[model samples]
Target: HAAFRAGLVVCPLSPLYKQNELSYALKKANVKALLLPGCESKQSSINDFHGVFQKSELDEIKKNLKHLILIDGNNSIPNFQGFEVHFFDKLLENDGNLSEEAKNSVTSDDPAALFFTSGTTGKPKGALISHYHMSNNMKFALAKGLSLNGPVSVPLPLFHAFAGIGASVYPIKHYRPIVLNNFWFNIKSTVESIVKYNCVEFWGVPTMVFNLCEYIEATNTKIDSLQKILMGGSPVYESLIKKVKRLIPSIKELSIAYGSTEFGSFVTQTGINDSEEIALKTVGQVADHVSLKIVDPITKKIVKIGEQGEIWVKGYCRMLGYYEDEEKTREVIDQSGWYNMGDLGVLDENGYLKIIGRTKEMIIRGGINLFPKEIEDVINTHPNVAEAYVCGVPSEKLGEEVCAW
Candidate 1:
């Protein structure tokens, strides 16, 4: 809130990042001040916490980072050369007396945050988003039936948009409280928090949901307050959804949403009152004010209904651009304002979107087109299988051989 009011662009770093990953983001973003976790535990040791700046390749990170505000400090200041290290409480006690001119200087066009995409293939790209984009995105979220009326439990990391906006921004917008899980997801603690806090809504990925289901059934922990479960970040299997429903019959909705960092979190979400078939089979209709197109990746032409193609999005929720990387930005987003989501999906006659797989992840074996999702979906249905990931391996004659784990 303070950062938004001050018009400072927020770049939330993942706590799981090692020194190399941390250094790359800090240097790339040119961060001047950093907020560190005050409580040190097995997850984040004292040396591990301080080693990020100490081991950075850029000298400016050590020299220019002026403030190190501790999130849970006890009024004790840390010593650093040319730095004003202080507890977050101390800064909160100070009064903000911004001049009228300074207050009015910031506009809707100003960048509010720089969220980095998980760069499994290469270095992470920071997506610069404006204040206008975030505000409208939240508004669209509310209109799409996201429950903001009661306490919500979110185990997803805050660095990612799923928990960042849903757990932090959305609650503040609606004057509600949000319950956060541990630095990393712990099945027991997450379920306990829901029962303890009476969280009316919960959100997580498919794996987390599977874990929760296993835990709940094993221990029979009852969370009567839980009314909805928002699932995203990857495709969810029908079997997993059915298991969750059977395990927790009290849950009225298991919404399936589709989104990415480039599109400001949620682009499509299943309705709260949607049937089990609609909720389980497809990522329900696209959000209002957002336009979706399924176009052939090679020709860039729209595909027929139910035919798989690259998904393109044109909406107010789209990111401004990849921060400091116009070359990369132009590669994905075109001049016509359509951002090509590299994932392949089909739009049903009812406008429901069904994600097939990534364009790059598709495999052609013996001239036969194969999607990993199709293979993964089949593998996931086995009773013994918890989840499945299918990939392609090089083959002498087939070109690619399907592999599963």
Candidate 2:
């Protein structure tokens, strides 16, 4: 938050990243300094928390590194040898006052953050977002009827936009208390925090919600403070919602958010007062000032209402572009400013969007198109089947064969 207010473009790195992954992001972003957690006790060292800095590949880069700011470190800070190292607290203790001129120089158009994609298909692509982009998105969420207030608990990591932007930005904008989850998501700890802090609004992904429900059921714990819950990042099964409702009746509203890092945060979300049928059937109506259209993926033409096609979005919250990747940027954002989402969806006449699947994930079998979502849905209906995933494999006879897991 300090970095943001100070007009510095913050790029948060996920702790789950390995040496190579971390190195790629650092070099790609041309990072000058890295703020990381350091060992607080004599028995432990930051070597485990910051294994990327120890990599031999960073030897040359270390010389050019401006500062190695260590957070949570004791009086003795490790010397990176070449680079200037400082304890996090010492920097705060000697923090210089900022002039009015510096604060006024910042503008909404200025780049505020660089968030990388999940890299599920390839190397992560950095998406540069401006201050106006995020602030407007937060306002859009609030105006779209998301009842967010009071203390909120966010269990997601800072690297993800859901936590970094949705959880952080809105709370700060509204002057509400925001509680950060542990580095590792633990059900017991998460539940205890909610009870301790009396958090009314909560944000989570499907897995986190699932684990919390399991823990609550096993321990028979009741939480009366929880009022609203937002879940996303993956498919939110109806069973999961039912389980949560059954375990904790205090929750008055449960909504789902659909978005990506490229869009700043949430592009669409279920309304707080929306019926269970509408909330369960769709990703909810598109947010205000956001234009959405369904087009045939191959033809690039608008599809009939209720027909499954590629989803396209145009709005104020869209990222400026993929950082330093103009070629890839042009592939998604066209001349008219509409971003081809690359996901399959069907828009009802009422403007609600039902995400079907991804165009890239479609399978061609014997010259017929088959969507894995269709197969997976059928497979998941089995009483014994907990969950199912369907993919396509090359086949000489059928061109492609369906593989289920």
TM-scores of the models, in the given order? Answer: 0.93, 0.95
Sequence-dependent TM-score of model 2: 0.95
Q: Give the C-alpha miss distance for residue 388 in model 1, angstroms.
A: 1.7
Q: Identify the runs in model 1 with alpha carbons over 4 angstroms from their true place.
A: 38-47, 62-64, 73-79, 146-148
Relative to the true structure, candidate 1 reaches a TM of: 0.93
Q: Give all candidates' CA lDDT scores.
A: 0.82, 0.81
Q: Indicate the residue-level lDDT of 71 in model 1.
A: 77
Per-residue error at 180 for model 1, in Å? 1.4
lDDT of model 1 at residue 362? 92
Among the numbered candidates, top lDDT falls to 1
Q: Which lDDT tens digits does candidate 1 get at residues 1-405?
A: 678778888988887777888888887887888887654524454335554655565466765566777777344554456667777777888887777876888898898888999897689999898888887776786466645468888899878977766665777677777888776789999999988888888889988999999999999887778888888998887778888888888788888888988888888889976778887678899999999999988899999999989999998888999999999999999999999888989999989988888888999999998999989888877989977889999999899999999
